[model samples]
Each structure stands twice: as C-alpha cells, then as structure tokens.
Target: MDTHIYTADDLDAAAKDIVEGKLVSFPTETVYGLGADATNEDAVKKVYAAKGRPSDNPLIVHVDSEEMVEEYAMPLSDEAKSLIKTFWPGPLTIIFNLKDNVLSKTVTGGLDTAAFRNPNNDLTLSLIKKAGVPIVGPSANTSGKPSPTIAMHVYHDLKGKIAGILDDGECQFGVESTVLDMSTDQPAILRPGAISAEQIQEVIHKPVLDERVHVADAQVPKAPGMKYKHYAPSAQVYIVDSPKDFEEAAKWAAEQDDKVGVMATDAVLNNLHFSNNVESFSLGSDVLSASHSLFAGLRHFDNESDVKSILAQGFSNDGIGEAYMNRLNKSAGQKHFNK
Candidate 1:
C-alpha cells in the first residue's frame, strides 16, 4: 500500500474514504489517530487489523463538537460538562455511558461505556465534521508499540499496512489524551495525558487519581485498550525513582554484562555512570516534556541493536506525570526496578 500525505484540501477525500470503511490516519493535538467510522463494525475491525491491535483493546471515538459527543454518549453530569467547557478541543477523553444504538459493539469492545474526545486540531476536526460520523481512533501504530505522535511515526509503523496519512507535523502533547471515567458515581482517571487529575478535581470539586486496575473479562470490557500490555519497546525497560537509585540500578544493569541504555532527564543523566558501550538519552525534566519524548526516545533506543536494556527514571505522579507514569509503567512491564 502506498502512503499518501494529505493536505487540508485532501481532508474531504480522506473523510470520504473513512465513511466507506477505509482507515485514514489523521492528526490530533495529542497524536495522530488511525480513524474508522465508529458505527461501522467492519470499519472498526479494519483499524484493529491495520495496526495489529487486539480486538479486546477499546478505541476512543473522536467528535467534532460537544453536540456530536452528546449524540453518542449519555447526558453528561455537571462535572463532565464543566470539564468539556474547559478542555474540549484539547487532549481530554471522557468515558461515559454509551447511548443506545449509537456506537457499534466493536467500537466499545462490547461494553456499555465509550471513550469520547473532541480534538483541537483543525485537520482532524474538519475530517470529523466532513465524515459526519463518530470516528473510532486509536494512536496510529501497532498495538504494544510506541504511540505515533507525528505523521512519519504513523508511516513508519503503518506504511504498508494502511491507506493514507495526513501529515500535519509533530503532535503537541506527544501522547494520548487524559482519559477520565465519568460514567460512575466517582470520577476516576482511566488514562492520564496533558490534563492533570488536579485540574479535573478543581473543576469537579472531587478527588481523582489513577483508576484501579480492573481485570476485564475477555467477553466484554469498558474499553479494549485497558486490557493489554501497551507501549512496549524491543529492549526491556526499568524505572527507578530517585537519581541515586537510578545510578545504582544502572551500575547493576551494566554489571549484568549486557549493553544497556538509560532514559532519563538531562539532570539524571549527569548523575549516572554506565559502561562506555551504553548510550543515554534525555526525556526532558518535567513530565510534559518527558511525555513528548518518551515514545521517540524508546524508538531511538529500540533501533539500536547494541542497546540491550533500558533504565528509566520514575516521574512525579502529578499533572502530566500521571500519563507519563502510565506509559512508562506499561513499557517497563515486568522489568520495573522500584527502589
């Protein structure tokens, strides 16, 4: 398959293809999304096949406006409404009860809830409007791999597998949206992104943290993406909290007699010592900056064959740190080295 770059004018054509059950890769403020018509089961399945994503992992539906969101999701609570007023057209995803007959079972992974977001980017919003359909869009990459933040990242992972890509440049957030579960009595964060829990609590007047891990029954799930090991790299990843612990762990990792790589902020990099064969890359100091560089850095390390293991520094569990930690944790998987 040939990957075509779409300009603003090509958005209509892209939307047309999406309506016909074709997968169209487009940009969002957070990352590029591989979009399919959410109401079309076949179209949503195409997304799963194109990116090699598991059917059990759920997709987030993108709407052009709040009214569009209301059509698919149940009436929003005052808290959900407040959040939308402040953060819609941005990197915020709200999980709510699905309206009857709105989304296909494939879109919600046969669950009663759905994840929805109204993206701020012009190209994506226009495509949503033109398509005139709620789009089930996940990050445009193979499941369990790094999420694509730029159009090329999409091409790199999906070039031969998908149809076309809309290259609007690098994503602003460089990660997925902050996902809040508003369907329940207590609002909880399903996924963290640019919007922090503190910011959401400030508006809702309730405490919120990361949602507890729930084992989804294979038959049904609130969202499919929640059930899988995601954002993994080829090399094993380990996370340590403080600079001292990271140094010690790096020493230990080096002593393993394997070529290791270190992923941390510039400050942490200055404090660690590794074998001359080991390479170090900075994910920036703050969580937001780290989130931006996380996937690209992993991809860089993954491409280098000599780098056998990756040691990462733990991020603060605040603001964007919540999202950063989620991705980091998933990437590290069983390789996490807590101290």
Candidate 2:
C-alpha cells in the first residue's frame, strides 16, 4: 500500500508497471488519469476500486496513436473518422463499438461501446508506447469529488490506493475531455470539455447534439460525469449569476451560523463586501483562468475545514467557458440563485 510519486525520468519504470497490470496515475492534457491496462480485467477493476467509481460508469481508453484505435475498436463510422482526423491527440473522446477480447469488459461497464482518446501530452504518449497496450483510465480522484488537475491533487486523493503517480505538474485544461458518442445515429456529446459542441459541429459540418440540452430523467447516461453528482467539494456550493446577486448571496451566507466562503473572479471579487465570517478565493480574472483554478479552488476551500458553505459566481458558456460552467454546475449540483 505504498504510493510513490514518479517524475518524467521515471516514466520507463511507470510504463513497465502499467504493462504488467499495475494501476498508475498519469497526467494528460485535460487532467490526471488513474490508468490500468485496458486489456486486463483485474487491472481495470482496480481502477474502479481506487476511485470508488461506480461499476456501471464506463472508462475512457487512451491510445498512443490513431492506428491503435482500430486494434481495440472496429466499425468506426465516417463521422468518427473525421473527428479523429481533426481532434485526435487532443481533449476529445469518441465512442465506438468495442471489439471483443481486445479490451477488458470492466472498461465498458459490460456495455458494447468504448470511449477512446489520444492525449496530447508527450509523457502520456510515451507511457502508452512503452506499455505496449491501451490504457483505460478515469479522473484520478474518488468518484463525486472534484477532478484532479495537478499530480499532487492525485496524490492527495489517491495516495496509497494506487501504484504510482507521474508528477507532470498542472494540467492545461482543468476539465475532463469532451465525450462524443458516435454509437448514435446523430453524434451526441455526452459531456462538455475544452472542445465545445460548436467547434465539433464546425469540424463535422453537422449539428452536434448535447445531451445536457434536453431533460431526459428516465434515460441512463453513457459516459462519465453524466449520471453522477460529480466534482463536489465537502461544502455546500451555490451558483449566483449576477454580480448583484452574488453580493447578496455571499453576504447572506457569511452572516449565517456556519462559516462560509466565496469564489469569484477579480472583476467580481473587487466589488463584493467581505466580513470576518467569510473567506474568499479568486477563481481568476476571466473564464480561462477560472477554468484552470475552479477545481483547485473548490479543493482549497474544502481543506480549510472551517468553511462550511460556498457561493460561486456562475460562468457564461462562451468559448472555454462552456467547460467551466459544466464543472461548476456539477459542483453546485445545479443549485443557483438569480437576481
């Protein structure tokens, strides 16, 4: 039960462990992933156990190159090919009909479809190449908690629970990858991330459907971050859209019997009034910075222990703001206050 942190220099050792079916946490451009050999059912089950993730929640398989996709999956549609041509080696995961015997059944949660992505990180690619097998992984944290953006974040949540961690530093994108389900007639985005739906639509020359746009309570989700109340901190989180509303919400929470915290951008932080009862954290000046700091901020406040509740300013779904809003909504569990 000893968990060690590995640097770039230790990648060979890490890859060796991974190939031998040891659970290793590695960094990707989007976030740190708790990886296991995709072809090994026991190794894949260890990933679910490490994260306390649901057995039914599918994992995303990461490959080193586009050609490897064909080895584990088959019957890729024209649309899936186009997306791979455009977004592979990036933060987009495309769902395909999984091939039999090549991948562990645990990876697909016993389903016929599997999600695939080729991360743009050199270390990750090198690890995959060295391992000589596809790696199926999920965010390196306990299920329902904020996703890990830095290697230490992985250690904080998963230390001793896994094999080893590759400390490649903070991830470029704080959010998880965009999960596109090509198994459907029309391509549907099961989750939003750095790659926006509009961007995908422009690439495909077809409208990309977002599952979040509609309310389908009865249907089960096909990807991670879909059916679960994810990215939550220990504190109760609420989103306030307007600056005026945020001020009111922050003040009200601070004055309550419980200790409170406020998460805001520089623009909104300067305008809000603070009391001894409330502690404030800056999400950043803009949406991009907010995206980078959102999860960390949530985790930071949680570490304080005294902060019982938090009020975060709602982000607009513009540009990378889409992913920012998605994480915030999940963290807050869709609780919002408007003026």
Candidate 3:
C-alpha cells in the first residue's frame, strides 16, 4: 500500500482522509499518534492493524476542545472537570466513563471507560475539528517498540501500513501523555508522561495516586506502558540504577566480545572508559532533556550497525524523572542491576 506524507498546508485533505475512515499519523506535543476516527469501528480497527497493537490495549481519544467531551464521553465528575480545566490541551490524558454507543468498541476495548486528551498541537486539533469526530490515537510505532517522537520515526515503523502522515517535525515531549483514571473516588495515574504526579497534585490540591511509580511488579497495566514489556529497541537493553552500577556495567560491557552501546547522562558518559567495541551517547544532563532525547537515543543505538547491545544509566524517579525512569525501565524490560 502507498502511504503519503502530509503537512500543515494539507490539513483539509488529511482531515478528509480521516473522516473517510482512513488512518493518519500526526504529531502531538507528546508524540506522533496513529489516528483514526474514534466513532468509526472500521477506522479504529485499522489503527490496531497498522501498529500491530493488541486489541485489548485501549486507545486514547484526541478532541479539539473540552466542549467536545460532551459528545464522546459520559458525564464528568467534579474532580474530572477540575482536571480538564487544569490540564486540557496539554500533555495529559484522563479516563472517563464512556457514553453508551458513542464511540467505536475498538477504542475502549469494550470497557465502559475511554481515555481522552485535548492535545496542544495546532495541526492535530485542526485535523480533529475538521474531521468532526474524536480521533482515537496511539503512538505511531509498532507495538512494544519505542514510541515515535518525530515524523520520520512514524514513517520508519508504519510507512506503507497506514494512509498518510502529517510531518510537524519532532515532538516537544519525547514521551506519551500522562494518563489519569478519574472514574474512581481517588484519581490514579495510569501512565507517567511529561506532566509529573507532583504537578497534577499541585493543580487539583488532592494527593494523586501513582502505584506504578513505586511498584515495579504491578502485573496488569491500567494504562499504556504499564504492564507490557514496551519501548524496547532491536538490541538488548540493561539498566544500571546507580553511578557505581553504571560504571561497572559499562566496564563489563566493554570486556564482552560483542559490540556494546551506552546510554547515559553527560556526567556518566564522561566517566566511561572508551574502547573500539563500545559506543556511548549522552542522553542529556537534566531529567527534561533526558525525557526529550530518550527515544531518539534508543533508536540511534538500535540503528548503529556496530552496536549489538545497550547499557543504560537509570534516573531518579522524582518529578519528571518519574516518567524518564518509567520509559527506561520498560526499554530495558526490567533487566536491571540496582545498587
């Protein structure tokens, strides 16, 4: 199948394609999303096939505005309204009770709740508004792979499998949106994203629950990136949780006969012992930059012909570091040495 790349100038055509039940990959502030009309069952199914994503893993719906929620979602609670007021049109997703037969069955995975986000990207919002329906979108990449943060990353994973791609360059946030479940009395964070739990608590003045943040062995994922072994590269990944462990792991990888790669902060990279068999990448100094470059760095190492395996230095799970550590843990698939 032929997949065309669209731009901001071609919003009308892209919107038309989506309304016609065709899949389209577009950029959001968080990551590129493989989008389909959320109300159309056939279109939503195409998204699953394109990403090779499991039908059981629910998709998030992107709407143009908060007012659009009345059409696609069930009545919101007071707490849910507060959250939407605080974080809509940003890197935040909220799971609300699904209205009866309003959305495609494939979108909610037959559950009574659906994830919704009012993205900050102008092009994406314009396309959704033009399509006149909420678009259910997951990250534009093959499932269990690193989520695409750029247009080319989308093309690399889903070129011929989809309809078209809107190239808005690299995404602002290198990770997926923070997903919150507001169905229960106490809100729980299902997925960590650019927006930290602390930040969410600050907005609502209520303690936000983040079980997945502390519990590594949580079996069932309430949201994407939780229960699955996801965001992995082609090569094997191992996480070193401390500077001591990182140094030891790097040295150990260098001694191995197979080619190895190291993903670390500048300080960690500076401390590494370089050799012909090892390639090291600086994933940025601070947590935010680390979050922004994490996927790209993973993809970089995966594409390097000489790199056979990867050793990544883990970050502290504080503030945005929570999101960073979450992705690294999944990318490493819990192959970690904690010190």
Candidate 4:
C-alpha cells in the first residue's frame, strides 16, 4: 500500500481513509494513534497487523463525543460520568462494560469491556466526526517500541505498513492515556499517563485504585500496556535514580565500546562534559517537561546507529512524575543505577 502523509490541509483524505476501512494514524494529546473504524472488524485487524500488536492486548476506542462511548460501552457510573465531564477531549481513557457485539472482537480483544477516549487534538476530533464512527487506536509505532509522539515517528515505524499519517506536529502529553478500568465495581487504573491518580480521585471524590494495585492484579487486563513488552528501544535503557549518580552513570557509559545515549534534565545535560561516544537528549527543565519529552528522547536514541545504551535520569514518583517514571521504568525493564 502507498503510504501518504497528510497535513492540516489534506485532513479530508485522512478522514476518508478511516471511513473506507483503511489505516490512518491520527494525532492525539498523548501520542499518534493508529486509527481504524472500531465498528469494522477487517479495518481494526489491519491495525494489529500493522503494529505487530498482540490481539489479546486490546485497543482504545477514540470517540468524538460521549454519545459514541455510551452507544458502545454503556451503563457509566456517576463517577465515570464525572470523570468524562472533567477530562474527556483529553488524555484520559475509561474502560466500561461493553454492549455485547457493539464493537468488534478485534477492538475489545473478545473481552466483555472496551476502552474509550475522546482525544484533545482538534484535527483528530474533526477526523473522528468526519469518519462518523469511533476509531480503534493503539500507539502508531511497532509493538513494544517507543510510542510515536510525532508524525515523523509514525512514518518512521509505520510507513508502508499502514495507509497514511495525519501530521499534527508533536503530542502535548508525549505518552499514552491513563487507562482506567471502570468495568468492575472497584475502579482501578490499568496504566499511568499524564493524568495522575490524584487528579482522578479529586474528580470522583472517592479513592480509586491505581496502578499499584496492578502488581497483584493477575486477572485478564482490560487495557493496553499490560501483559505486553512496550516502549522499548533498540538500545538498552537504564534509570539513574539520583543526580549525584549522573557522574557514575556517565563514567560507566563512557567505558562502553559503542556510543551511549544520555537522557536528563537541562541542569544535568548542561553541566556534563561528554566523550565523543556520548549522545545526549534533553528531558527539559523538570519532571513535567520530562514526561513531555521521554518517548521522543527514547526514539532519538533508537534512531542513532551507534547508541548501545541509554542512561535516563529519574524523578520523584509523585504527581505527574509518577506518570513519567511509569513509562521510563517499562522501557528500562526496571533497571536502575546500582553504582
């Protein structure tokens, strides 16, 4: 298939692709999502094939409005309604009990529930409305690689594997949505993202279960990023837990035969004097900035031929920092600086 790149001027063609059962990646607040009509089984299957994603891992359905979500995944609790009102048209993805046979098994992974989101990007919102159906969207990169935060990243990983890509520039959140499973009586977060657990609790006025509960959650997962190897790059990534450890980490990186990549805040990157073998990507000035740039930094290292390892800086696991570490930990396989 010829992979066409779409811009704001050519969004109609992108929308048309989605309606015609073809794959077109669309931008969201979090990341570029591989879009297929959720109601079309064949179209939805193409997404899994394109990304090499596991069928059992499921996909998040992106809608233009609440009606689309309610139409397929219904019986929303009052809390669910509150969350939607507060965070929809943004990065939050909610899992609800699905109406039987409303969405294809390809979308729901044959589970009784489905994940849904109303993305914050204006171009994608227009595309969803134009397509006239919710779209099944997983990150537009190959399965188990860093999620594409830019359209070029999608084109790099998925060009020729899918139909086309809608270029809306960089994503705001630079990560995937917070996956909240409201399918059960006790609500729990299946994954962390820009939307923090504290924010969710603030909205619902109740203590909702967060990703910590998933350590003991052995049940079938209702969201993506669980039971799957995701966001890994070609280079082995290790987390440096303290700024003081940066020197040791740098020394270790310098000793490696192949060039090593370093991802850290401006404070660290600016002070570091690098050997010729070091490739550095900045994580901006703080944790919030780090969350916005983490995946891009991973992809940056992934694109470098000589990079064999990436030493990423760590942050306090609180607020949005928790979200940043969640993804970083996964990519690093929980490997930390022991030196």
Candidate 5:
C-alpha cells in the first residue's frame, strides 16, 4: 500500500480510511500511534502484522470522550472517575473491565480488560470524533524499535504497510503514556511514562503499585511494552551513569575499531573532546530535554552505519526520569559504562 501523509486540512480523508478498516498512523501528545477502528478485527490484526508486534501484547483504545468509555467498558470506579477528571486528554492510559463482546480479542489481546486514553493532540481527537469509533493505537513503528515521535519516523518504518500518516509534526512528550490498571481494588502501574506514579497517587489519594517490576515474566502483558523488548536501535548502546563516567567512556570509545556515537547533555558534550570517529547528538540541557530527544537521537545514529556503539547519558530515575531511564536501559540492554 502507498502511504500518503495527511495534513490538518485533509483529516476527513484520514478518518475515512480508518472508518473503512484501513490502518492509519496518527499523532498523539506522547508519540505517533498506529490507528485502526477497534470495532474492526481485520484492521486491528493488520496493526500487529505491520509492526511485527506480538499478538498477546494488548493495544490502547484512544477515544474522544468519557462517554465512549462508558459505551464499551464496565462501570468506572470512583478512583477511575477522579483520574479521568484530573488527567484526561493527556498522557495517562487507564485499564477498565470490558463489557461482554464489546471489543475484539485482537485489540484486547483476549483479555477481559482494555487500556484506554484520550491523547491531548487536537488532530487525533478530531480524527477519532470524525471516524465515530474508538481506535486501537500502539506506537507507529516496527516492534521493538524506538517509538516514533515524528511523522517521518513512522514513514521510515511503515511507509507502504499502512494507509496514511496524520502528520502534525514532532510529538510533545516523545514517550508513551503511563499504563494504569484500575480494574483491581488498588491501582497498579503497568508501564511508566511522562505521568509519574506519584502524580497518579496524588489525584486518587492512594499509593500506585509499580508493576513495571513484573515485566520479564511469561504471562501475557495487559498493555503494550510490558512483555516485549522495545526502543532498541540497531547499534549497541552503553549508558554512562554519571558525568564522571563520560571522560573514561570517551577514552574507551577512542580505542574501538568502529565509529562511536554520543547522546549527552550540552554540558557533558562541551567538556568532553571525542575522537573524529565520534558523532554526537545533544540531549538538550536536562532530563526533560533528554526524554524528548531519546528516540530521535537513537534513530540519528541508526542512519550512521559506521556507528557501532553509542555511549548515552543516564539520569536519576525520578519524576519523568524514571520513564527516560526505563527506555534508555532497554535500549542499552541494561549495560552501563565502567571504562
């Protein structure tokens, strides 16, 4: 299939494709999401096939309003009500028990519960409202690769495989939404993202279970990125834990047989002098900027075939830093700098 990028002026056409059960990639505040009408099983299966995503990993249902949630899901809890009031139309995905035979097994991964969110992007909300159906959305990229924050990144991975890309430029958060399971008595966080657990706890007046710990098990994941290896670039990534480690890491990279790439903050890059073979991408000034640049930087080096190793920066896992490190650690395969 030839993929055409649809602009804001042409969103009705994009919605038309989605309504007809064709795969369309759309923008979200978090990342670009591959969209298909959740009511259409064939459309949902094509999403898994296009991205090579495992069938058991469920997709998030993106909708335009809370009424849409009530239409398909079981009654929402008091806490779920509070959370939606606080963080709806943003980067928080909540899991709710499904009404019998409401959504396809292909969309929910055969689970009784489904994850749902309303992204803050206006283009996406308009598209969902225009299509007049809830859409199942996973990140728009090949499975196990960095999530696409820009529309071109989606094109690079899924050009001919999908119908069209709803291009609204670079994503704001540059990461996926936090997946929270509210089906249980206590809310559990399935995946960490821009919305921290502490933020969720404050809104609900309760502690959120950090279930990011149970990810490596054999059980089927309740959400995407839980049971799969994600955000991995083609090159080997070594995470430098501290500014002190970068000096030694540079020396080590100088001795390597192939070219090296560096993903670091402006301060760290200014102080270090790498060999000519080393190419660098700035992670901006701090952790917030680092989160925004993480996937783009990794993709930057993927274009440079000569870069066999990437020495990337790491920050203290707090606030949004937790989400940043979670993706960085996966990309680096938990390998840290010691040289």
Candidate 6:
C-alpha cells in the first residue's frame, strides 16, 4: 500500500475525507496522529478499529485553535485558559469538562471530561479548521507499539489497517504530548511528554497530579493514552543505570552469544566496545535530545537484522527526562537482567 505524502495544499481534501468518516493520519509536533472527526461516533470508532486501540482508552480531540476547544469543552477554568494561552500550538494537552452539546461518547470514551490540544503543525491545524470539527487522534500506531515518528513508521505499522496517511517526515518531539486535567480546581498531569509538569505548575501557579489513578471503565477517562502499556518495541529491552553496567551486560550478552543492540547517550556511545553483530545508536547529549530520538532509535535497532536483545541507558527522572524514562521502563518490560 502506498502512503501518500500530502502537502499543505492537500489538507483541505484530506479534511473532507475525515469529515466523511474516513481515518486520516496527520502530523502533530510530538508525533503523527491517526485522526477522525471527533463529533462523529462512527468516525471516532474507525480510529479504534484502525489502530486496534482499546475502546475504553479514549482519544484526544485535536483542534486548530484554543477558541475551537472551548466549543466542545464547557467552563474551562482560569488555569486552563492560562495554560492554553502559554502552550497552545505546542505539545500540551488539557482535559476539561465536556460540554452538553458535544456529540460523541466514543471520543470521550463515555467520560464527562475530554482531552484536547491545538497541535503545532500547520497542516494538521489547517486540516482541523477545514474539517469544521475537532479531530480525535492518538499516536499513529497499534496499541502498545512505539509511537511512530516518521511517515514510514506509520506505514510500517498501520499500512493496510487505515484508510490514508499524511506523511510529514519525522515528528519533532518523537513522543506524546503532556496531558493535564484542568476540570478540577487544581491542575493535574495525567501524562508527561515534551512539556513538563513543573512547567505547567509554574504557569498555573498550582501543583499538578503526575501519578496514575485507577478509573472505572464505565466512566470517561480524564486523559487518553494513560491506561495502556505503551511505547513498546518488538524485542526485549533492558535499561541499565550507567556505561559500566551497560558494558558489563554487553560482556554477558556476548558470552551468551545473543545479538545485542545498545542505545546509549552520546557520552557513552563512543566508549562502548562490542562485537560486529552488536549494534549501537546514540541518544544525543541531553535528556531532551534523547526524548526526541528515543522511539526512532528503538525502531532503528528493532529493524536491524543482527539485533536480538536491546540494552538501553537510563536517564534522570527529571523534566522531559521523566517521560523518556517512563517509555524506556515500559519498553524494557522485564528487569535489566533476567536471573
């Protein structure tokens, strides 16, 4: 199946297809998203079917403007307004009370609150505006898989499964957006992304919730992408603390005759010594840089013919690093060393 790379001019036509209940994959600043008309139950259902996403997981409504988000979500608090003013057209998602006239339960997953964002990409923003309704979108990959950063990743995972893909090169953030629930008096972060929780708190002048809480399936989810095991790679991945531990593990992997892939920070990449079959990739100098390349790096090694096992370097659990570490831990699945 051919994945069409749409230019800005084609956004209107693509938006038309989405408005007609077809699935369209478009770029957000963080990652490419599989989008459908948020107000149409049938259209929103197509997103779940196409991505094999769990129906109960809910979806984030992508709007072109902050004003557009207000139409669907009623009574946005002053905190929500402040955050939107500072972070809209960027990688931040806010959860607010659902307006009475909002039509689709599928978009909210039967919840009273919904996640909404104004993405930073021009094509996506224009498409949402052209569609004349919010677009329900999540990362353009099957559930539990690493989020797609490039058009090919989407085509690789979702090719025959979805109707159309709007290739916009690689995603800038290569991760999901920071999700904050503003329905309550104090802002709460349901998920972390490129935007940090501390940053949101600074803007809103209140503490934000960063931990996960159990919710009933019958209720609407406060945030999308919160309930699932996400950002996983195909092969088993192990995240280690430092270069010394990674080197020790490499030796162990070599002795066991298992092909290993090492994802390291730039500081450690050049120092690691491994066999010809042991592949290595660098995550750059800082945590933010690593966050931007984490998924793509995982995809790179996941596709390598010689890779059987993966050893990933752990990052500090601060700022955007928190989100990067969360994805790494999820990808690792098991402990660093199997006993």
Model 5, 62-125: lDDT tens digits are: 9998999999999988888889989999999999999999999998888999999999999999
The model with the greater lDDT, 3 or 6, is 3
Please give each candidate's TM-score.
0.92, 0.95, 0.94, 0.96, 0.98, 0.93
Candidate 5 backbone collisions, by pair = none
Q: Summarize candidate 3's per-residue lDDT along 1-339 as a digit string, tens digits.
A: 788899999999899999999999989998899999988898899988988887767889999988898776778777678878888789999988877888766787667888899999999999998999999889999998888888888888988898899999999989888998887778888888877787788877899987564324523334666555789998888887777787668668767899888888888888767677888888888778888989988888865456778888777888788888888888887788543
Report lDDT (Cα) of residue 339, candidate 3.
35
The TM-score obtained by model 3 is: 0.94
Best candidate, lDDT-wise?
Answer: 5
Inter-residue clash pairs, candidate 3: none
Per-residue lDDT of candidate 1, residues 1-339 (tens digit): 777778787887888888888888989888789988888998899898998877777789999988898888888788888999999889888899977987787788778898899998988888888999988889898888888887877887888777789889888887788888888998888776788888888899989967747555554455534677888888898887766788578668767767787888888887666677678889887667888988888877875456778888787777678778888888888466754
Angstrom error at residue 22, model 6: 0.8
Candidate 4 Cα outliers beyond 4 Å, as residue runs: 212-219
Clashing residue pairs, backbone N/CA/C < 3 A, model 4: none
The residue-by-residue lDDT of candidate 2 on 75-180, one tens digit each, is: 7777778888898889999988877767766888677889999998999999999999999979999899988988888888988898899889899978888988
Q: Is candidate 4 or candidate 6 better by lDDT?
A: 4
In Å, residue 83's CA in model 1 sits off its true spot by: 1.6
Error of 1 at 198 (Å): 2.3
Scanning candidate 6 in windows of ten residues, the lowest lDDT window is: 212-221
User: Which lDDT values do the candidates have, in the order given?
Assistant: 0.82, 0.85, 0.83, 0.88, 0.92, 0.80
Cα lDDT of model 6 by residue, 95-211, tens digit: 888878575777877778888889999878888878898888898988788888988888788877676787677788888898887877767777778888878878978778765
The Cα error of candidate 3 at residue 207, in Å, is 2.4
What is the TM-score ranking, best to worst? Answer: 5, 4, 2, 3, 6, 1
The C-alpha stretches of model 1 lying farther than 4 A from their native spots are 216-219, 271-273, 304-306
